[model samples]
Target: MHLFELTCTAYFKNDLDFRRSFETISHFITYAMMRGGLDERHTKSGYKHYVFGGLLPLEADKVYKKGSTYRFILRSPDEEFLTALSTALRQNIDHPDFIVVETHLNRRKSFFITELYSATPVIVTSEGNLFWTMEKNGDIMQLQRQLHDNLEKKYQSFYGEEIKAPQNFIQMIEIKNRVPQNIEIHKEGKKIRFFGNKFRIVPNEDEMSQKLAFTALACGLGEKNSYGGGFCLAGGMR
Candidate 1:
C-alpha cells in the first residue's frame, strides 16, 4: 500500500465550509482523474481503489480562512491510480482554490497490525439499513461477523483471490462511539447521507489477520470508502 499526502495552500476566493469539503474534494478527485484521461477508472463500478482522509486544516473551525495551508491523505494499492492522481494534481488543482504545493508518498507493507482506529467513520449496513450496536442487544459477535465478511468481500474484489477466512480474525473489540453519526455528501443537487460509527479494533495473532488488516488499511473498513468513509489508521506503522 502507499499513501500520498497532498499539501494544500489555501487562497479561498469564497468561504470554504468544512462541512461540505468532503463532497467538494470528492468531485475534485473525479476531475483530476478525468483530466488525466483516466475517466474510465473513475467511472468504474467496483472498488474505487482509493480512500482519502478529510481536508485537514492548519488551524480553523467550520470555515477555512485565506492564506492558510491545509492537507489531506490518500491511500491506495493501485500504483497506476496513484500515479495518475499525482500527475493530475501537479497539472492543476485550483478548484477549491487551493494549490497542491507538495505531495509526499509513504510506502507500507504487511506489518504487524496490532491496533486500528477509525480516522473516518466506518459505514456498515445490512439489508439497506444502518447497523446499530443495539440491533442485536449489543452483540459484539454479530458485529464482528459483519465486519469480517465485509473485509473478505473487499479483499476478493481488490485482489481477485479468495482469502482463507480465519475464524473471526478481528477479535474482541470496543466501539468508541455508541451513537452512530451521519456523514452527508452533496451530489447532483441532491444530498446523500450514510450513518456510520467509529471503532477501535484489535486483530488476532494469525497470518490471515495480518492480511485483512492491511487490506482494511489500504481499502478502508466498510462501505462508501470512495467518499472518505471507513479510513483506518493502523498502529505500529513505520
Candidate 2:
C-alpha cells in the first residue's frame, strides 16, 4: 500500500480553540472533495480512505487566533484521493475564514518496524460513550485488543477484505502526556462533544503485525480517525 501525505500551511480567519481544529479541518476536507467532483454519499461513506493528524506546532492549551500560521498532515493509501484533495485545496478551501497559504504532497515510506507514536487522541467508543487510551482503568492489553479489532474492521470496510487478528501482535502500548479534553464537533447539523485521551502504541514482530502497523499509519488507530483521532508517526526501527 502507498501512503501519501498532504502538508498544508493555513491561517485561521477567526479566533478558534485548538479543540475545534479537528472538526474544522474535517469540514475543509469534505468541501475539497465536493469541489473535486465527489458526491456527498461517497464523501460521507463508511469507508475512510484517509485519516488526518492534528494541527502542528501549537500548544495544546493555547487558543489559535486569526492570522496564526499552522500546519497539519493528512494521510491516505490512495494516490488519486490525495491528488484530488490537493487540487481542491489549491483551487479553493471552503472555509470562509481559514485560508490555505501553501500545500505540498509527499509520498511517505512505511516504517519497517512496528512502533508508533500518537499525534492525536486515540478514541474508542463503548456503549455509546467515548473512551480514551489512558482513562480505561490503565489496561493496556485491553486497549490494544480494541485497536486491533478496529483496524481489522477498517480494512474490511475500505478494502472489502477481512484480515485475521494476529495473536499477540501488540506487545506494548504506552500512554504518555495523558491529557483529558473534550472536542466539540458538528455532525448532521447538530453540535456534539466527545471526550478522549491521546496515547502511543508499540507492537511486536510478525508479518501481520507489520501490516497492522502500516494500516494504522494510513487509516489511523482507534475510532473517529477521520475526525482527527488516533493519528500516529513511526516510533523507530525495531
The lDDT of each candidate is: 0.73, 0.75
How would you encode candidate 1's per-residue C-alpha lDDT over 143-200 as one tens digit per residue?
7887888788878887899887658868757678768765789768798777778898
The numbered model that scores best in TM-score is 1
Using alpha carbons, what is the TM-score of model 1? 0.87
Judged by whole-model lDDT over C-alpha atoms, candidate 2 comes out at 0.75
- Candidate 2: give the clashing pairs: none
Where in model 1 is the C-alpha error above 4 Å?
A: 1-13, 58-60, 94-97, 131-139
Candidate 2, residue 228: CA error in Å?
A: 0.5
List model 2 lDDT by residue over 1-238, tens digit each: 5588989888878876786788988888777777778656345867576788877778656777687888888998778778777877767555765877788999977667657887877777654464644555566667777888887777677667777855755777666764665557987889886666666667777777777788888888777777887788886663
Q: In terms of lDDT, which candidate is strongest?
A: 2
Clashes of 1: 0
RMSD of each: 2.6, 2.6
TM-score for each of the candidates: 0.87, 0.86
